[model samples]
Target: MARPEPEGRVRRFSTAERMVHRATGYLMLLCLASAACLYFGPLAQLVGRRHLMVTVHEWSGISLPLPSLLGLFSPAFRADLRRLNRFAVYDRQWLRAVRRRRKSPEARPAGKFNAGQKLYAGWIAGAVLVMMFTGLLMWFMGLLPFISRTSAIFVHDVLAWATTFVVLGHMRKALEDPEARLGMRTGYVNRSWAQRYHSRWLREEHVGDLSERRTVE
Candidate 1:
């Protein structure tokens, strides 16, 4: 069970959602930090534990999907996954508005996830899968005699850099929206924030009855 939203706020993320995000984010940070130590010669020397760093990096990347997999057991997480999968008419309108560099949350309303978010989610999901695959291949070159370890390493390195940049960009974007960060952190967001950026989602919520909702259950 959960407490009521604050008067001016509404439930945006469920507890399960926040837990999964936090778990995945922490694991990702671990992987990136270990990778930085492993990949950079100076850092590797400074860290001075090559074998330990390799072990940490390998295991962290391998565990990256576990939080998301476990989250599937949560009804709230499953519901949000469905939301992330669907793309409606308003999603297209949102993308168009984004390309034109204008804010039209009302006319080009967005649901729980806008087009850009959906794309980013899809891309990061795919990238993680690819990274896992390539990383495994690199770790066990003997497992695939036909596949070149060099090629696997190349792809892994490229994707790692791309993921780093994309993650940095994501963080920068999140910093621009304090309400969004608050929603993810505390499971509630100001009603006005939802109305401005996720008007469609706000409309779908029972705004008047938020006090009756159990946001953390």
Candidate 2:
């Protein structure tokens, strides 16, 4: 179990997990930017570097799963993976309680990752796989039928837009919860933050660490 750094905080992300997150962030941004440059004529002309943009997007897409696969080498990373895979009774309740925020009793015993977070993780994992498959098909256009290549490009473009929307929504929610960011960055979150946002997780994982958070000061 990862613990706080002596400030009464609780460890939320391991160093390995943070590294994977940072790598994913950078790679996703690179993929998005380079794809924009390659797909948009105006942007391609603005940058005047279509040659390099294609290479950047291709390699970035190819590397999207590297960080996650590499992070499996860490025990903490593997443990977090298991936790994300496990959806308890509280998880379903947490999903229903989203609109109610903390007003619902179901929100009281949420584990480390709420239902939303689990869904997001699952979603992005599937999205990445889709992107990678379509990207490979598009890249090796000559190896496949012309219609196949066309289909891949169409799916890839649509998923690009979908992923953009999902990421933006995630960013908006993260902005509303700065302590969640702190947990990722510092590997710890104030105990009170855990209590409010993830009471059951704190209580179940840490001994004497469940400090209920009512409001932020």
Best by TM-score: 1
For residue 83, what is the lDDT in candidate 2? 82
TM-score, cand. 2: 0.87
TM-score of each: 0.91, 0.87
Candidate 1 per-residue C-alpha lDDT over 105-198 given as tens digits, one digit per residue, 9 for 90 to 100: 6656888888888888887899999999999998887888888999999999999999999888889999998889999999999998888888
lDDT of 2 by residue, 1-217 (tens): 3332767777788889999999998999999999889778898999977888889999999999999999999998998888888989888777667656766544556788887888888889999999998888877776657557778889989999999889888889889989998888988889887888788877777544343322221
Candidate 2 has which clashing residue pairs, if any?
A: none
Worst window of 10 by summed lDDT in candidate 1: 208-217
C-alpha root-mean-square deviation, candidate 2: 5.9
| lDDT (Cα atoms) of all candidates against the true structure | 0.89, 0.83
